[model samples]
Target: MLKKQKVSLVVLTLLLLLNIVGILNSTQYLLKILFSYFVLIIAITFLPFLRQKINYSYKLQEILFGLPMILPIFLFKLKTISFAIGKLKHFEIFLIYLLFLAVVLLLLHHKDYRMKSSSPFIKLSISKKEVFLTILGMVYSIFTEEMYFRFFILSELEDYSYYLKIVFLVFSSFLFVGAHYLNKWAASMFTYKNYISQFILSMLSGNIFLVTNSLFYSLILHIAYNFPEIWLILKRLKYQQLHYENDGAFFDDY
Candidate 1:
């Protein structure tokens, strides 16, 4: 393996091992700092010093510029973002997102459907602005992940036999899905739909990369897969906020 490939593989493998230990012991302390972790990944992965002179098709060489998105987390407590929900198409698109979420939920975890219940903790746990930032952060992380698991890994193995490349891709995709299991910070996040989404993404991302040789399409797929979880998050938060305003209760359900 090349020096860079060795570094990438070791780093990802160490993370997987850490998550495995976390799963066994139920330690998610790292989960709280995941935003910072993603920031670091985006920075180091694209940094010229840590990587070789490999040109990328996606042109993400300057990803450090996006680190400023974290400023909202530390500097501001923005209550509202306009979210610009006043438009007609915005509602239409939101409805589409809801429809998609419903279909997936029914198909995957229909037996244990408990979405009707509101989460009181969520009202105080996160805010609308944070959720919006999370959505953007999610997008950036998706791109970063696909770039690592698809483009960089596969590219490093390009000199190997085609069959060997397939094997590595399959293994890498497995690691990718397994990482999602480590990201199970909430019950809603680890639903059957979420697991299935990860599995499908693990397979499809590799196939897409193999066929198209670009992370752009796989990045889109990853984001699309997370839509259900994202919707549920927003739903609970919106519910809590409305109740908070109308009832003036301390930490009531959303």
Candidate 2:
């Protein structure tokens, strides 16, 4: 087993609050700061120069250091009460997600679990604004997802049998992707392929995130994926609200 830090109850509580507040505000500032910190942590992990300079005895010190920074994002996502209502109204979709996750778990256990690289595609240049937004999303994903699934769920499920641990790991991964799919499907932002890809990606990503004991890389990738789409959605909502208010004002004038 990797040398692990026993996170204190006080620390965990604080981390949860930080992650939740950051996401709830939908602000990019904290996100950017988190991504920057993630990069720093990643660098310190791989670079001997930085590693030697730091006064830490633990191999996974970066993970612990990041917890306080990451907690808010986790708390922010859970702060919303939408999940309670959605699960009630969209029971079929919910069941389908669970079923699909079971299939993914079975597939993972099969011999063909190795990853295959996709064909090379043209890449877009990263704009400053895009970079900024992605960093935000990265912060949000890293803190919130890691805390909820890897830390909170895993810690709580520790009492289960070894077989159950495996099952929980697989199911937790599925639930993570399924949650995204349900929300994205309702928002009309995600494709069927997108959900499938994300599910696979989440499984792989979760393993790496836990293994490295650093949520930084996972945060970067998620934020990069989510930033553009979320920005567009917010802009659209703002535009519609403005249009509606102006129309109301015009009627009043007439």
Candidate 3:
């Protein structure tokens, strides 16, 4: 496991180097290499094909991916650091509410993200209080991360056509998944059902951002993307209660 993890780290480092140089060179070959690296990370980390067990490889990938994901946001925050930090203006409040509504709808429809009996994210001791806390943490974590990745980063890329924007969103999400592949490889794998769902969702959200000229919608969608985890926690809490009352009838035969 340790050897496999070391190799994984090496691969991650090489990919980062290739990505940095490739971004600067802007050559097709470099882009191809970077893309391949991203795919490899996805396969080895997420797909069962690899037969390699590395301790918390997915979690490590999340941290690794998260750094690059957060960098653009950090730069934006720095650029705006000296700006006013006053009370919310009317327009700002309206935008916030709109974002919130989108989030609610997005969460309601998101299915794969929800916890299932066999999902890795579901733990045994979940309670209502823990569910709420996890939901809050997941929302905040995804919101800040999305603000940087989807909203701010997309804003940086030139969106000359809807096609270009779509390309960027898919590519960005690909990288986004790659960076955090360690934590959620299932969602990151291009071949996974959830991956396809997220890809389509991201493409739609990107187009919506372009059409509406509103970053608020994108922000809400980003937060809503995390609804699956929230749903899972809540489900676990309810299931625990029911199971307790039922005297383990569900598992008693086993």
Candidate 4:
């Protein structure tokens, strides 16, 4: 068991490093797709080994409890879209406030603030095909991440004492955050705020896996948390393209 744990840790660490490289170096669609496939292959190859270690049963309740914690962030994104569309009526704003309050209360009741601590910034100029590929890549990447960080890393420490577990969790979470920071775009804007937020997300994700004993739950939460960021980025990209086209046409007419 010890030997297997050590080997898995080494493999996961190397994979994380490779993933960072892929993120940093892949500047075009083909390169990005290649890297994504590379990660997916590694993840799929290790799936069986990781699956054996997971004992958590899938229950509807886990999703039910976890989904609402994400509502506030989605609401915030929706509020942005609403503002973009037109002026929000007084009643609409008031209703949004009420919804936000309710979601906060629910999160507090469930102690889900950990999941709410951070948001990911996805700043990529991707085409429509790349967007589709990116979504698929993200899904696969999330699976691999849960397998490595949550299942393989965490399970390896299960037999140890609580202090050791906590230490390993923090250590792994730091590595997880470091991997994100390695992305070329993210690294340029890296701040303590991003670091802290990623740490919080990593910790919460690990805890969710521990509690639910299911990587699926962690993956679901991860996707739910990240989807809005992707949506926001796409919206911004579309708006920018429109503005650029309009400016070009105006100059051409003049």
Score each candidate by Cα lDDT.
0.53, 0.44, 0.52, 0.49
lDDT of 4 by residue, 56-151 (tens): 432322332233223322432321211122233533543443454345334433333333322232233434554554566566666656655566
Per-residue lDDT, model 1, residue 83, is: 16
RMSD of 1: 15.3
Question: What TM-score do all the candidates reach, one by one?
Answer: 0.47, 0.35, 0.51, 0.43
lDDT of 2 by residue, 1-254 (tens): 11111222233345446777774452343343334333333332334444457866533443443454345445444322111222232444334444554465445432322211111211222333444454455555456665555544443333557676566567657656644543312346555555665666565545434434344444444454444445444444445455444323322433
Which residue segments of model 4 deviate by more than 4 Å? Answer: 1-128, 233-254
| Evaluation by TM-score, superior candidate among 1 and 2 | 1
Q: For residues 90-161, write the lDDT of model 1, one tens digit per residue.
A: 345445544554466567765544443344444454566556656766677676566555654454454567
**Which candidate ranks first by lDDT, i.e. highest?**
1
Top-TM-score candidate index: 3
Model 4 clashing residue pairs (backbone): none
Query: Tens digit of lDDT per residue, candidate 3, span 72-156?
Result: 4454352231112233463465465446545544555445343354575454755555565567666556654554555554654
Q: Model 4: how far is 46 from its true place, Å?
A: 23
Tell me the deviation in Å of residue 49 in model 1: 28
Model 1, global lDDT: 0.53
